[model samples]
Target: MSYTKTQTNPTPFPLVKVGMGHLKIATAGSVDDGKSTLIGRLLYDTKSLTTDKLKAIEEKSKQRGFDYLDFSLATDGLIAEREQGITIDVAHIYFSTPAKSFIIADSPGHVEYTRNMVTGASNAQASIILVDARNGVIEQTYRHFFINNLLRIKEVIVAVNKMDLVNFSEEKFQTIKNEINYLATKSDFEAQKITFIPISALNGDNVVEKSTKMSWYQGETLLDYLENIDTTLTNDSANARFPIQTVIRPKTAEYHDFRAYAGKIYGGDFSVGDPVLVLPSLTKSTIKNIYFFDQEFDTALSGSSVSITLTNDVNVSRGDMIVKIDEIPTIAKELEATICWMDKEPLQNAQKYYLKHGVNDVQAKITHLSTILKTDFSGVEENTTALTLNQIGDIQIKVSKPLFFDTYKKHKYNGAFILINPKTNNTVGVGFIKSPL
Candidate 1:
């Protein structure tokens, strides 16, 4: 078999835009299941890697006494990861095609690195869960899938890798696909779109190019699917939410009265003449002007970081949320959230921590541990006592101040928070707001 290097240009496909800026993907699988190799294969096949990178892979593969190029080297950048042949941290990779730009978060698959996986998948719009054909679906596979479901990732690609080891057996691929399909029926995210493909990351079959060995398979390659997948967020449909990051004031002789609230739009768009409400203070104001740097825009869409001058100065400051007057979020001192515990210390009731919701921070305490969720998507263990490291559970929390937020399902950016250990100043947990409690 000959390994021919291809140029880094994507083949033309039907142009499709989902109104999203860039696509973010998280990859997960069991150890030695070729998760890193699959990513490496994608980069290699896409011609995203530089000449030095290809040379490095060739030298490393020869040094390791491997006949084929070790594509895993392309993503496993850490010295410990390269030495141990296991990914320990999340490695972010950026590459673009003619159709779209992509950011892949290569997450660790070890059982202990479940926290790491959550960190990667939290911001991802899609997920790629790899399953070794020889091993089929295992415990780790269930955990990864559960995380994707919990995050509400709408799209998933289940790549049954190492087809070469299975002699390109169609039966083996079908069995694995059937297993995942059955698992999906039990998942909370029943509407998730899952695509299964047989691939050999080592030999680059069905990753970027069609696999001649599996002639019965008539689906697009993994690259084809990702390039055309719709990754648009639902922010367009949600209410406008802009958490004030800072107050922009130019104390100059010429523009001494310029005071504007600066932040990124987290939800729907905002227009110049829109009626806005300042949260907590409940101050009413009208947008006088929207400025993106020196240029002014009539309207600002979600995710755009800009400054807005209000018609009246109602004492707005940092941590204040400016939202549409008609579509106000729940403002409450107590909240119910699904939290993924990340610290080594178990999450106990009455434990105080600093909760950061967007740019706002407030003192919070866990009031109740409702239930400990099982990661296998089987069922929930109700009335759980505590959540240990890497365990996810539902809890009620009391905050020092009222928080203006939406449900995570409704608005992702406005619904997420991080619990900081006040004493140690470390981030201990991540929470997704369910509703005001």
Candidate 2:
């Protein structure tokens, strides 16, 4: 894994705008586990819902002869889902607090829709895994926990819902906690921060507000935990990665000589006059200006969406990367990765596919199938040949050209990619780059 650099300083440029900060969260659980109800409870308790929406929910609940409001009606929007009383797609809900804004991805929990759950949790900073108190831990719990561990979500909130039905028993809570704790030791995600909260989404106890019956429990409410979490827990700031999305060249009179490359900064910050390498081609350039909308800035930190103008007019375009010359990614043509197969048809051994990494999409082929990972995250199935839908497996792929990448543990944003079936133009799998070619 290696890359070369070329240095060139062109013209002095203007400043760039600042960045925006927000937290992204996702919710998961097995069917009938109150995932949607918990989200509705959060929104309702926080006063994020409108008066009309509340009235509508009340009317629908009464018409259905329900004594209590069905909060799940707030997000289960699909016609089929509403008729079936199950979540079938991803619902992205927005809410804001004084400390930080949040984007909640409500994902489906059924085993058949595990692919949609993966899509929802892929970009989340934290996740909420709901458990039905009556059922305790079950098979679907293992599946959801496995997905969370695989995605490397920083925080896990094991929300034990429907506590009211169980009489808010301390013994039941402890039992579930012990079970999850035991399973945590068997997983590869031991470093994750796990928090447990007992709540009744139907009655709104211990979810948004503290429960009076559960006097023995003493901890911050779920809302408090979510709002007070440190921003640093979401991403990394050590290694810097920039994948170029497009080359912006203003062929005008006022800025006739300007050449800018637009992309999002991933790992660390990039300052003006910092030396960079244009990957694959190994061309070198200096950062002259960083632009966010219409302002100027001296440096752009990780996760900032900005356009950077270079000192030299090298052959750079979409799919190319602008990275620090000294800290380049591994350049290779073969890769070993963990893949989550999403397509209905199982993976074919000799088929060619397109790998979309960052903003670059390139042709690739599956050269070897190594092992299939169990849902418990304990170990892999050695000597496997193919992966079926919703199956996770280790595979070796050969790409048409070398890709600049890092391990998923080091840099998730740059080390992750999606596999597309070229003929159907459909995403077939979600993959994490495990190592260089």
Candidate 3:
């Protein structure tokens, strides 16, 4: 495949430019789809791998009696994974170019490890769905595709891997692309942008470098597309939300008067004097000052950790959110959610547990069992009494106190929460809250 910067969105601050920014992506596919090899190729080609790591990889390949350097040896971390020649967990790899920094989560491809893939892809802005060029598509491919859509990943790169095994035939690549398109059309996603690339992870063709044999293909290499992607296209830069983590009061000689609310901005922008409301109490306040680290700032953007002082000290404390008054999310005691059962035991009705929403944790009970989702098809089995491990289901829960939340589709940070077993302190379920109820 070769990529140039297609578009660049201008930002007032030179450092905040879109196309020339870091991007986080997750990679998924069925078993033995070469995800690890692809990641190693990216690190090696970009010269981001340290000399020692590269040398260790070469030595390991030789130890295994391989003629060519086995790139998968670089990321297959677990002993069982190395022995089985499969990725059994998520391995986070970091690399960067002059254009942008990259974090790739190489997730396990086996059916049993679907939860691991979900954990890795939850925070990703883009995802790569790999398909073996020889095998085309299968049922696991449908499951992966469904999860990608469910997570609302904006960009999907359908990498048809191991093209060298198929003689780098353009027909094979086209067939895989067509199959993916058909599968995508059947999904309930927002019609994400899908790019088809033919590559051999083992041979490193069309990965970081253009393939010479594929003269018929005239497109950007995988790395090129990744590096030049307009990251602003996938960002939610509109809504302003800041969940207060701690009330900062540095009791010092010079900073005795400082009473700042410290927290990371979940979404949106904050100006010097924007009208904001403190949630869980609904007390109104206005920003008096915004301080990032030790420096006093006039504004703070999303993902930036900062502290703010309110005009009225209306008893705001830890776990309280300061958001635009008109844009405050719904506060309710009862909630409907889509949950992924994470425990070995099934989720039973009338069971009381702890619900951890953002920084605020509360006790909750399962009031009703709505439905269990069937992964193969986008349908539900209603009136389910309990949810087993790896099962996705609709549930109604009532909490001891009201929670400030948004629908999962609207605001991911607020929409998502986790269920914990109070007795064991283990996370048993991951859930996305349903809105307007």
Candidate 4:
């Protein structure tokens, strides 16, 4: 595997504002599959590496008696990782091309580290699953794809790394692509879009620049494909939901009547004239004004933190929600959710835990351990007694009070919750509401 630096110039790609410029990408692949090298090559090819960082990598590579630079050293930060030549923890690598900035979560591919993979990819907008050309699709490939499916990640790139080892054969690439396509059909998620790219990450072919060796792949380079992604389209929502984080009241005597609900809007935009209903109490209100610090706006877009005043000073507090009347979510005390268990202790039926759903915390008890979903896209494992570490399953939970929520498929922002052990205060699991019960 070899590439000349002149194939393309590396330039700093400015991370875009809020929702436009930054891309969060998670990566998973088996050991020796070149995940770290791909990340390092991206940094190096894009001129994102500092002189000192490059020097450190170069010195490490040489000390190990390697003639060629070991790009993997760039991301394997931990001493254990350096010694083992494998990624154990999720190492976040940031870089940019001239078009867009990127944040890559280099998650481990080992089965035992599945929890880390879930944690790393839970909030990612995109993912990359690396496969060694010589080995084709392996067990870790299936696990990585399953994680993407479970998280409902919309866009995925199947990067066939180390293509040089397979002599850059077009037939080999197609074989792997067909396997992945077949696997996608088995996923419970129906609309996970996937793109295939054959590349030698170490050689930098078909990554920043198209590969000349395989003239067969007439597609955008990896970087070009990433740059062209419109995140807004992939992450669009229409149901306006505003979960109030706090009530803002200036005690200063000059403005004694100023009252506002402070929170970040999700799902859709909200204008001053939009009619909304406060949850739990079902209090009716109209948006009077929107304020960000001191500046004011007639409308507030999703992903913005702002304070909004309502025409009515109706009783509203933290944990209450302001939502468009037409798009009101299910108000329920019991929930049916798909949970990914993260704690070392198995999740037992009827266990009491504290569940925190976006800005709202409540006491919860497991009503049932329905079934464990297999990670290979196979059907569920029935009659499961308990959910063990790194296992995913469906469960019923009863909260202390009625809450406003949506299905994970409908509104990811308001549908997710975390289970914390009351004794240790450690997060035990992450749950996505499948539906209100």
Best by TM-score: 4
* Total colliding residue pairs, candidate 3: 3
Compose the digit string of candidate 1's lDDT tens values, residues 302-326. 8789999999977988999999899
RMSD of each: 3.3, 9.4, 4.4, 2.4
Off by over 4 Å in 1: 1-21, 233-236
Whole-model lDDT per candidate: 0.87, 0.83, 0.82, 0.87
Q: What tens-digit string does per-residue lDDT give for candidate 3 at 19-137?
A: 34778999998877888888888877766677899999999999989999888888889999889898888889877765677778888888777678788888888899899989888
Which of the predicted structures, 3 or 4, would earn the higher TM-score when compared with the native? 4
Off by over 4 Å in 4: 1-10, 13-19
- What is the Å distance of residue 345 in model 1 from its true position? 1.6
Candidate 3 global lDDT: 0.82
Q: Could you estimate the TM-score for every candidate? A: 0.94, 0.93, 0.92, 0.95
User: Which runs of model 3 end up more than 4 angstroms from their true locations?
Assistant: 1-20
